[model samples]
Target: MQHLLGLYRASERDIALILQEAAVLKPALLSSPPQSFSFLNGKTVVLAFFENSTRTRTSFELAVRRLGGSILNFSAATSSLQKGETLLDTIANIEAMQVDAFVIRHGESGAAEIVAKHTRKVVINAGDGMHEHPTQALLDMFTLHETFGRLSGLHILILGDILHSRVARSNIFGLRKMRASVSVCAPPTLLPVGIEHFGVKVFADISQALEQCDAAIVLRLQLEREAAGFIPTLREYNTFFALTDEALSKVSHKIFVLHPGPVNREIELSSVVTDRDDTSGKSESLILRQVTNGVAVRMAVLKVLLYDRA
Candidate 1:
């Protein structure tokens, strides 16, 4: 198989096969964890993050370690990247280190594709601007697979910041590829042009989008867009797009809530819903499960792309 650059770029059969593999591997990874990786054990994975992230960075690091591989961290502030070293030159130096994988996050669109073209090592798109967050979509599909037992015909609603959310773009592709129906719920300003072309239904109102959906993935309102002139104010966006408990109550009982991390509580999601444990009080929230599944799904990705002898 070729490198997985975007979820929608994958064939339907391939997506189904990965989903099936994830189902079988999730229990194995969670129970009898591998001491390290069988194939990646001595391999070095480079984490080149040019943007801010807590979940994607930490999850990738944990996934590498759990697979028995090591990582070399690279941040722009402490590296030659700050001194104007080109992305190509940096990747070349890292490639010379015999790295096995390059998990990259950059603020520019198509940055990962550029690195994929220039580098000899495997390139995983952690995120590249508003272009795509392929792994996030993978983990989300994992989470849904775990919770719902299937992907085809599932109704998923993605809420907020669609104009600048790599998550939305990737999920649109990932979900559609898996034969799921997808909808984007956001204010007009927060949505990008030509969203319908991606094969997702669009909703200008959050309440309408939530109606009878199987799951809802809420995206935090990206403040950076304000500077980029994509949006005007947090106050207005919150008033319109924020997913309060009140908003969640409007959705069907079967609809599960999901969010990618650094959740702006009361901004993108209600703390009451996201922060709450189940009846046990000690049980983990779905957000925590999302994080946990991130590692396993990434491990599956690494194993399939880097190790599978097929």
Candidate 2:
């Protein structure tokens, strides 16, 4: 077992095994009193998120706690990182305390890899700028597994800001590894110059990409990454790639929608689409389910990394 620093370093078999493990573990997680794994009984995890994160941070902390591990949370503003502390120095201080794992998210590309290179402790990249989000990709695979019972042969459309989305990059690799058909839909300006090298079809029109997809994932449009002249307005981007209810209806009826959140609401999707209850009406929403799956996926990741099974 080793640190999951990036999706490119992971093999197709590795992706399959984690998805399989998550499926088995998810049932136990929902049981009344909850099933627990004792593999982490005496371990300590340090969550070092340099960037602000609501779901990834909280869910990972919860996951570690549930596995009987303790966690230390550190934010950039509250720590010496704000004072120009090197990533090595910051991790070294934590490593001195015998931390078993460092779950990190930073705003610079390759920041997690640098920490991993310098630290003795296992490193998991929660995210690294626009590089990758391996855990998010795993959780997404878990969600797809639950829905389609298989990852292969499913047409998945990744829409919106592909140029700056670590989520899209991670999903493309993980999905490709699992033999799923993946496509990207975004305005030309919002896509990377040579992303087709990843082997996914690129589409400028959302409707054309959605027509044959079994699932569609909307990457959160990162306003912070937008340059002054990137686009004229958010409304213009939405008009082209946002998955409104009408837009969703144009896709296959079997399509399931996904978003890595802090959703931009009407900007990425209409309120009616996000608000509609499925026929069952019992499930609160898909967003929360994605959040929950994140914990399970990360748990599987931690277990595999530390327990030497994956």
Candidate 3:
């Protein structure tokens, strides 16, 4: 519980406790009369992001502030890293300031682990390359749990660029650990090697994957993957895999849709699907819920790591 590097490292009990805490905290976030907690009062948290992010970074910052903690935004562009300082060296210098915790997002896999290894302070992995994005997975789980009342035996399909998606890897670990039936749908070229061994069934046909699933999480196409020759073009990829309005109509059961944000308009998901509500009259923009739950989930994580409690 000291560090949330990946969901695979957390037991089912640990996951339950975090979600339970998030459930308690979420009410405060939505209260008409705003409320705040002082759980992290007198604590200082450093937001060290070596990667560009909008949702994750903003949510972590808001999580810390709402819990009454001081934050120091670390900018890699203007930092000593630009002057050839090693990642650890910069972190060591920051650690010298006696920060209570470090929320790190790095493009290199195991970067957060390295920080945790070298420092006595708590380290929460916001993201670390294609290895894991534990908090994102936690929020996604929270979103699902909030909607369906549980995760056990729920069929969830993660659709899109699997090869370069840290989100997919983390969700696969977290969802399966929660006893959800997890599957993935992606183009052959975009599917990573040995992904099926994670106890997830892989599907090339999007329609087949959508059938009978409780929910489908559409992923944003990683443009970098195209340069690497995993995909030929965005239009072609959309033709085969995009979650259009037409695709949702084919699903016989009531199915929900989830997407991690910064969505590609016509690529991973169609513009029509993103804006429309589901057949059940619920908002299809689970992306907004994901962003909202992110703060609560992160607050739960900070409480676990900082106070050793839910």
* Ranked candidates, highest lDDT first: 3, 2, 1
What's model 2's lDDT at 48?
A: 92
lDDT of 3 by residue, 226-310 (tens): 7888888877888889988677767776667789888989888888778766556322657778888999999999988887642
The estimated TM-scores of all candidates read 0.90, 0.93, 0.96
* Stretches > 4 Å off in candidate 2: 224-227, 277-285
List model 1 lDDT by residue over 1-310, tens digit each: 5466777577776666666665665675666644455557878888899998888898888777776788899987789888989999989987897888889899999998888888767888899988999889888888887888888889998988888788988889888888899999887877788888888899887778778487888888756766876667776677777776666566555457788887887777768767765644311247788887887777777767777732
Q: What is the C-alpha lDDT of each candidate?
A: 0.79, 0.82, 0.88
Candidate 3 collision pairs: none
Q: In candidate 2, what are the lDDT values of residues 1-310, reduced to their tens digit?
A: 4688888889988887777777777877788988877778889999999889889998898788777888888877878867988778888988998889999999999998998889878899999999999999899888988877888899988988888899999999989988999999888888899989999999877778878677778778767544566777887877777888667656545457788898888887666656655744211135657877888888888888877542
Instruction: Indicate the worst ten consecutive residues by lDDT in candidate 2.
Output: 279-288
Residue ranges of candidate 3 with Cα displaced over 4 Å:
278-283
Task: Choose 2 or 3, whichever is better by lDDT.
Answer: 3
Error of 1 at 60 (Å): 1.3
